[model samples]
Target: MMKRAEQKGVVENEAPQTSQKSKKQKTCSYGSVFGECDLHSSVDWGNLPHHVILRVFQFLPLVDRARASSVCRKWNEVFHIPDLWRRFEFELSQPATSYLKSTHPDLIQQIIKRHADHLQYVSFKVDSSTESAEAACNILSQLVNCSIKTLGLISTAKPSFMNVSKAHFASALTVVFVNSKSLSSIKIDDTPLDDPSLKVLVANNSDTLKLLKMSSCPHVSPAGILCVADQCHGLKELALNYYILSDELLLALSSEKHVDLEHLRIDVVSENPGQVEFHTIKKQSWDALVKHSPKVNIVMYFFLYEEEFDAFFREETPVTHLYFGRTVSKAMLGRIGMNCPRLIELVVCANGLQPLDDELIRIAERCKNLTAMGLGECEVTCRGFIEFVKMCGGRLTQLSIMEEVLIPDNDYSLDRLHLEVSKHLGRLWFPDMMPTW
Candidate 1:
């Protein structure tokens, strides 16, 4: 019995030893396999050509490029390049508001510090929430100290905290004007600017400002606009909305020497000229403005209570682009084609079409440079479209017809129209069903 027990213990000990040896062999094989896989799978960061990597980064959006830099140690080193930062700034400003909102404040400051010397354009919005007025002022101060040329300020949000007297909002504005020596264009939205405020802005930076947009500013009056026209010698583009625009202001702007006005946009509610009674003085003012400023391109959005289309269409101003909305008659279209020979683009939105087919054809024939035409929510048939295309097939590159198709019978006409358009058209945009052809 003792001999049998000793033999069993010895067998048990030998079995454990054999199992341990097998387990060690398996682990070694797995380690070898894993090592080989890692060596083959690893990206050769050093072997990647510099220009190829830079081109890849250039294709990425600004935010994605920043993210790519964080992928690894080698990638993180690429962020130090100055040209990369400049390209990022350019792409970042394309979607200004969203980019500003997504980027961290600290990261923005870091970017400003690193690439401030190369900064050319900066657009930022400040609301009472998200950031304090003081913080906004600080950021603007940094940018002004930089070489930024274009500045856009949009105050979309109202004051968050009730401490209006203690707020640094005014100081922020002061900092903007004081440091913005290189600013050429300025766009301010949703802010009321009194005459005094306008004077301060113009007095400080009028000489350098080339374009100014003060849309949705309730406190801006005709006086303030005239003040800008008089003072800002280099002003080229002016956009005014919600503010009162008068004939006197237009007259003053017209008489200025070498006005250099390239673009003008005005939204006004006027009850004058050819509606009920012709305001000769206002008409003369507009005529003189257009005639005197040979280079100026005018865009007016006026709301008249009881004015005929003839009142607005009488001015034979040379416009590169024309857009008309509200209750416009088909007869007026013919008048416009006869008057504005230099018109290149026409965008019309009306309720019904009385007899504008001949007028449209005339426009296509006359305006050889006519590249785009937008007929929005108008009563237009596919047959009329086919006729227009046949006349201006070579010049018309873009035609947008929205909400015009009424009947199932028109589908066949639409199909034919699409086939004709597909031949000469390089780009086609439709709001409804996609074109079959």
Candidate 2:
């Protein structure tokens, strides 16, 4: 009788345990069916290591990361970790806008107050309004403990950075230059940035600076840029205007103390398109740069009026990527053959009703490394076009000719031309295609 009583007690204990287990399984299933639990909350995700979870979360956007934090308490902690905030881009749009959703004002304040120190790579892209620039400056001045490694100040509008007063932009930027002593990259284009602030930056972070891009800065003179090149021995990539590109600057960059430069970009922007006097850079200066850094890529972007293009492409240049914004003439295209022998990409925006047969043949014969060609509002004969394609052959990766560029003939009709070109390019060809914007 005592043995029977003991067996009954054991059965009673096992019964309740199994019942509880069943109840828990039912609850999990119900929740899964009702969408109350996501994949991350499921049993499979719970088994993942914490490091893997953190790595997955790191790749998510900031807004998506915020949503992910709600999955669990552990994820919430990982979302707020300082390491996750190292690389960040703050899209500071106004409260209500058409293009992009505005970042909340309260969240911006919170990030500045609590997480400013965690930002290592940060970029502030502002809208057209001056208010956004002011807000950026205000936050910049307040980052007393920031140790930013890379920082970019970008303006969506062309003239918006100038809308901010020079003094204000300079003073606020000085704070960041003074604090972030280990900055490696800085891109501040279109700002009314002057020399004194540059001096402050070079004095503090010149040793660590590597890549600097200020393509459209009008306030900085050649002397200011020279100072940067002299001090920043580790600079690898630089972009500037034709005005600052002098023999002395190239020599400064060629110093034995400096590392081998990798890329140099020149923005040929015109302030007044109607001006008669066109600025030019000597070929000898470019030759010296080539001697020092043979493998370096030289890229040039032109934003000129039709009148301003007369002085360009006078002699041999090391332009790998060339853009012509204005309507180009046959003479200019002809000179391009002689000057840009090492050309890789050519984009001509507009060309008059003249046939570009000779120019096209000249480019194909001379520019052996040319891989892409684009023509807009230009003319090319059918036979000339076939020979040009045969010359470019399989090497031409991109041949964007507007439908109007090819003058159809009985021998080389549009359909026949496309069929022949497609056989060469290994892709569907259409001469009527528009130039990629």
Best by lDDT: 2
Going through the candidates in order, what is the number of backbone clashes in each? 1, 1
Per TM-score, the best of the predicted structures is 2
Q: What CA RMSD would you report for each candidate?
A: 14.7, 10.6
lDDT of 1 by residue, 1-437 (tens): 12322222112212122243443343233333223323334444433566666766666655455544443334444554555654222111113333334344445666667666566566555545434434545565565455556767654455421222223444455656666565678776555445666676787888788898876666677788889877777778888862455677666667656365788876544445443432322556757777767667766554543244445556555556776656566666776777676677788766464545677777877766678787765665555666677777767776776635322235445555676655546445333553569
> Which residues of candidate 1, in runs, are more than 4 Å off?
1-101, 109-119, 125-138, 141-144, 154-170, 242-259, 268-295, 300-311, 324-335, 353-355, 358-369, 381-393, 402-437
How much lDDT does candidate 1 score? 0.57
| Residue 199 accuracy (lDDT) in model 2 | 94
Model 2 Cα lDDT, one tens digit per residue, 1-437: 12322222122212122243443453344343323743345444433567776887777665555544444445555666788888878776665542645555555665677688998998888888778778888878888888999999988875566788999899888988999899999999888888788899999998899998998788998899999999999999999987777768888887778888898888877767675365666788778777778777888887777677777889888788887777778988898887887888898888888999899899899999899988877899877887888888888998888887888877888879888888777778877665489
Q: TM-scores of the models, in the given order?
A: 0.62, 0.85
Deviation from native of the Cα of residue 124 in model 2, angstroms: 0.6
Clashes of 2: 1
TM-score of 2: 0.85
Candidate 2 residues lying further than 4 Å off, grouped into runs, are: 1-53, 67-73, 96-98, 424-428, 434-437
Error of 2 at 298 (Å): 1.6
